[model samples]
Target chain A: MTRLTRAEAKARTRERLLDAAARVFAQKGLAGASVDEIAEAAGYSIGAVYSNFGGKEQLFVELLQERANDRVNRAAEIIAEAEPAEANGALGRLLVEVADKDADFAPLQAEFWLYAVRNPELMETYAERMREPRRLLTDLVARSVPDAERAGELSSIVIALFQGLVRMRRVDPDSVPDELFGRALRWLFTGAEADEEQP
Target chain B: MTRLTRAEAKARTRERLLDAAARVFAQKGLAGASVDEIAEAAGYSIGAVYSNFGGKEQLFVELLQERANDRVNRAAEIIAEAEPAEANGALGRLLVEVADKDADFAPLQAEFWLYAVRNPELMETYAERMREPRRLLTDLVARSVPDAERAGELSSIVIALFQGLVRMRRVDPDSVPDELFGRALRWLFTGAEADEEQP
Candidate 1:
């Protein structure tokens, strides 16, 4: 049998538990998933699940935090790699590709949001976690746009547009074409220029 | 009891069933809700539900169709009433207001979307229904923008932005402000102007 240090074993167990939680939650939904099922899926005992993470809710929150951070980091990398002029197009393409590829993530996210909204305390904490990512995206937008004045609001729109489009695409792929994103970005840029010229 | 034609009685029963469905689906979700509960809530027998709609799936689809039509019509009215110059701003304000005022609508819409994505057959038909509203909005955008070339694409963005912002508001109200919608519209117009001036 493979041997490991005490702390290393504990960390490995936690990782397994989280992986199982995400899969179970995605397949069965937050309410539908149970601690026992997650533990079984993780190949651990019920006691191990409790010892590793206090409960299912904590496990879920951790997963969301990890995902949020991972997404922002990945976005930063994409933005960093793209030429300044092509940054928006690259990001738009990236967002669409991510949304298309991850069938589990979006539904899981929507389910989590629904669950969090019903619990005021959870919602508050989750909302706080969201701020860091939103701030990062806002700063990124300000840098990308020709007019930095409206960057904050425009960034929010871009984020919202990506989310809403992905959601529609999920339900009906034919309606939301990949090229529409580029066109929309161009249109928004044109609008921003007009606004800047106004006396 | 007042005398009524057979068709009128059937219509009344169908309406009541739909009303009950909206309430139940919002509260309990598609999977969580049962046909018996919907019928009981409607104050009709199970047979009335089956006779009127054939099944829960049909009932849900009808509800979606009704909502989709209602939203497009309302949007058209909002656009029609606004002066040409103020159309985009007016639409932005209206979307925000509608999202803020109707708590039930957004959740119900999300739930319906979640339900549709899981069922491929339903998604195809639902997606088809979506195109009409998108076309209507696209035509509206073509008329609103100073530059009509990118209007169709811009319209999709506007729709996605509205949906995404409302969703964020539902989960975390502080992050998505009411005024942000106007600011976004303004930014897009400015960007468009800048594009036009570019050599």
Candidate 2:
């Protein structure tokens, strides 16, 4: 095994701690999870967690921000790859596909939001953390849908549907086929007249 | 206080236990919560919990079912109260209003869903519980929307948006206005032509 410098060791510890926190948070939830468990899961001591994250809440905030950025970046890439005309459809397909592949993501997100709501301080940070993603979503919706001004509303609707479907899919996968989200996006962009035309 | 009959006393204990379970589950989450803590919160013995619920998992299932029924029944009542002509708008308004009024319900629902996903044995029952609400929502959408066959898809979309908004609202209330949901419903029924005219 290659030996690591102090800086490299610190970075490695932080990354491992974050990865462990994600798994533990998803499995046990935010409010109910313990930091010692996170440290152990990372094969580190409690002191490592403290030196790296200060505490569990801070760790969670960093995790959430990292995740939010990943989602927005990945979505932007999907939209970028598609032609302007197909960007909206591509966006819808990407959202559904990501949710299908990342089963842990939804529960971890749900736990984060649940913890955020119960703790006002966390909610403020979370709300701020969410701004960029919403802005990106709004811009994409504006470019796709005919009514540009109401893009924010459309974005919210799409996001809300995405989150709701993710929750439903967790308990009832059969009821929430990925095609369902695609149909909703079509309806949003092209109207109900078009939604019925699809199989 | 008036003395209670045996049946009335038993009912009161069960009710208190369920209420306590909701609070405990919300505060500590399902997996982390213990039957002893729920019993203590309800001012009963662990024996009472076992007598009423068989175990923690059973209690959680009962709580989830109760909450789902409460949401559907309340929504049905709201739709029922509205005139047929105004039903769609009224339905959207009602969903938002109910969500705002019962903030705890969303987090609790999220927690329950996370738990359900982790526990495969519970998913079947949870899905079964969800079908009635979805059916009711589909029927309501069919009556209000232009296309009868597409109503189920529309219903799924609306429900997904509602759940997603609830999750988002918990973190960032400012970004996700309750009116957004109302407008989505209006757009679904009347299309973008109607959306542009709304304030």
Q: Quick one: best DockQ, which candidate?
A: 1
Give DockQ: model 2. 0.46
- What tens digits encode model 1's per-residue C-alpha lDDT throughout A1-199? 7789999989999899988888888766665678899999999878998897778778887887666446655676677667878876887687678668877776777776766655667877666666666677667767756565467666667777877888877876656677777656776766665666673
Error of 1 at A29 (Å): 3.1
TM-score against native, each model:
0.83, 0.86
TM-score of model 1 (CA atoms): 0.83
Indicate which candidate wins on TM-score.
2
Backbone Cα, N, C clashes tallied per candidate: 21, 2
What pairs collide in candidate 2?
Answer: A161-B160, A161-B161
**What docking grade applies to model 1?**
medium
Per-residue lDDT of model 1, residues B1-199, tens digit only = 8898999999999889988898787766665678999999999878998899869878988897776456656776678778877876787677677777866666677677776676667887677666677777767776645565566556666677888888777766766777777767766655655555672
Q: Per-residue CA lDDT of candidate 2, range B58-149, in tens?
A: 89888987775666656766676678778766866766665677766776777777777778888787778777777787777666555665
Worst ten-residue run, lDDT, model 1 chain B?
A: B190-199
Query: Model 2 segments beyond 4 Å from truth?
Result: A1-3, A31-37, A45-47, A144-148, A191-199, B1-3, B31-37, B40-47, B144-149, B191-199
Task: Report the lDDT tens digits of candidate 2 across residue range A42-151.
Answer: 99989998899869888988897676456655666567667877765676676667667777777787776776677777677777766676677777766655555467
